[model samples]
Target chain A: AQSVSQHNHHVILSEAASLELGCNYSYGGTVNLFWYVQYPGQHLQLLLKYFSGDPLVKGIKGFEAEFIKSKFSFNLRKPSVQWSDTAEYFCAVRSFMNRDDKIIFGKGTRLHILP
Target chain B: GAGVSQSPSNKVTEKGKDVELRCDPISGHTALYWYRQSLGQGLEFLIYFQGNSAPDKSGLPSDRFSAERTGGSVSTLTIQRTQQEDSAVYLCASSTRLGGLFFGEGSRLTVL
Candidate 1:
């Protein structure tokens, strides 16, 4: 039952508001974490990823995610939001066991930034 | 092509009917993947291919769902005896260097 979980289905915030999206995974070994975004009428694009090294990884468009191994969480955060940031965000996981290389994705979170 | 290309941006078929969706991954990309996206379920991994060979097919929902890749370029996902629950946007992606993926617009299937 190893899977990714996104805490929010929908979120609304005004421009310049701080944003935080929760993502957690249940897995037993070393894993890779990622965040992807799909803009309206656009294909899904990689926002950022965490493989190793520093737990905090920065990505495009002023987005960053902190991987907390103890908590099994990789939460996405942004200091300020923009109207253009309105889109669907997905959390994904990839385990490195080498037997199964499936990359599982969470349900996703829809963010609406009001101007 | 510049990115992954999926045919039939939208498809509507009757229940129990079989449908085929095609994906042309970026040239030289050895890794290709298929995923199902729906309202409730965000992204359901269906299959993965590496150089015309499938290493993982565990994510396929049932025996009715099958996929194949040819020449390490084009892939086809076949759904046999489709059900209403099969209505979803099917996404295809090709992995670039360093594990970054390039996605297609998706083929949206609507089973009536």
Candidate 2:
């Protein structure tokens, strides 16, 4: 069974601080990685995804993630954060070969950005 | 086409009752999915549908949970004899192949 793990359950940081959320998956096959964000009262939206390409992928809102195959990890990062960035972040993965693959999501990291 | 849409933004049902949650996927999208998110447990994949076929039911937590997609477009997830543990927000998402997914606002179910 494939699964994703988010190391930081909850993180609090002041504005302008750097942010990084750790994500690791348990799988030994071709995988598609993704990061989704949920605002205070909005639906889950795709931040970015990694199908096949460079290890580092930049997403909307100055967010980025690096896929490290050796470690089975895809960590999300943002050089500078804002209070509006306070939201829940989820990491998901699906096997590439599976045409109708079921995406497995991490428990999620709740980021609270202080003003 | 519009993104995925779910019915009954919120549902409150009594225990032992049956309830159906609906999901309308984007037009032309061949893939649809169902997931549940509890307060702190993150999102859990409940089912997946591709062109009216479900190749995987392994993610379903129990026999009480079942889902079906008709015409490869609309889907219904039914929970029989709902329990308090079944309380959570049911989310529906659709994809244009295996790419990024567009999600609905979700239907929050509360079983008492």
Candidate 3:
């Protein structure tokens, strides 16, 4: 079994302020990491994902995450956030070793961006 | 379908009543998942279907909750004798073996 842990439950940031949400996972084998976002009154959509290759991965809306294997972390970061970025973000993981293993989600971080 | 589709966008039912939520996955997706999203709980996975067979149903909260998929396309989640605590958004997502999920708008159920 695999699990995800999000360090922050809620985050408040002002417009143009930098943001970082920490995420860690517990899995012993190969895995695929993902970041999903849900805007107010909207469905959850993919922000970004890391399968392999470079540690840093860029996503939509100028968001990015770095997969650091040593720390078991894949933290989401934004250089400058906008008010429209307010939403709930979830970190998820799936086992690449077991194709049947279902993806697991963290508790989620609710981000509030002030104008 | 162009994307995952869930039905009964909103449902208000009395306690003890039964409810059924439907999910139609994106065309040709081999993996389908059902999740429950409540305030503060994030996404609580309820079940996973690989094709028409479910391999992991451990996330289902209770026996009153049941789900099934047919022809590897449409899935239905049934809650028998629903309780007030069962009120939440039931979300359905579809994906390939290694692809990210494509989520539906979700079916919100409110038990009174």
Candidate 4:
């Protein structure tokens, strides 16, 4: 079975601090990766996605993720985070199984950015 | 609708009662999915529907949980004799041709 692991459960960072949330998946086939964010009192929205091509994918709100195939990792990063960036982040992967493809999500990381 | 929509944004029901949650996917989307979010479990995939048929119902936890999509548009999840442990936020998402999904606001079900 395919599974996603997020190493950080909660992260507290001051405004303008660098951010990196670790995400690793267990799969051997071709995969599509994604990062979703859930702001307080809001629905989950796509932050970024990595299907093919370049390893580095930039998303909305100054977010970016890198898909390192060798490490089986797709980590989310931000050069400098703001107070408004406080939200729960989820890392997901959809493995291609010939026909049945389903997305599996990690436990999620709660990020608290202090202003 | 411009985006996915879920009804009864919040629902509270007694244990052993039945509950039905509705989800209307985005227009022209052919794929729909159901997921559950809980404090303990985070997020989990419950089912996926392609058109009006379900190709994957493997994530459903028990026989009491069932779901169906009709007209390839709306979906309803039914839970019979709901248990307190079943309390969680039920989320619906839709996609086109196996691409990124668009999620609804979700329906929070509290079993007391």
Q: Is the docking of candidate 4 incorrect, acceptable, medium or high quality?
A: medium
Lowest summed lDDT across 10 adjacent residues in model 2 chain B is found at B50-59
Clashes of each: 0, 0, 0, 0
- Per-candidate TM equals 0.94, 0.96, 0.97, 0.97
Give the per-prediction TM-score of chain B. Answer: 0.95, 0.95, 0.96, 0.96
**Candidate 3 structure quality by residue, lDDT tens digits, B1-112:** 6999999999999999999999999998999999999999999999999865645798999999999998888999999999999999999999996689999999999999
| lDDT of each residue in A1-115, candidate 1, tens digit only | 5689998999999999999999999886888899999999999999999989999999999999999999999999999999999999999988766555557899999999999
Residue ranges of candidate 2 with Cα displaced over 4 Å: A97-100
Candidate 2 docking class:
high
TM-score of the A chain in candidate 1?
A: 0.96
Model 2 accuracy (lDDT, Cα): 0.91
Candidate 2 at residue A104, lDDT? Answer: 76
CA shift at A83, candidate 4, in angstroms? Answer: 0.6
Q: What TM-score does each prediction get for chain A alone?
A: 0.96, 0.95, 0.95, 0.97
lDDT of each: 0.91, 0.91, 0.93, 0.93
Local lDDT at B111 for model 4: 99
Candidates in descending TM-score order: 4, 3, 2, 1
Looking at model 2, residue A74 earns an lDDT score of: 97
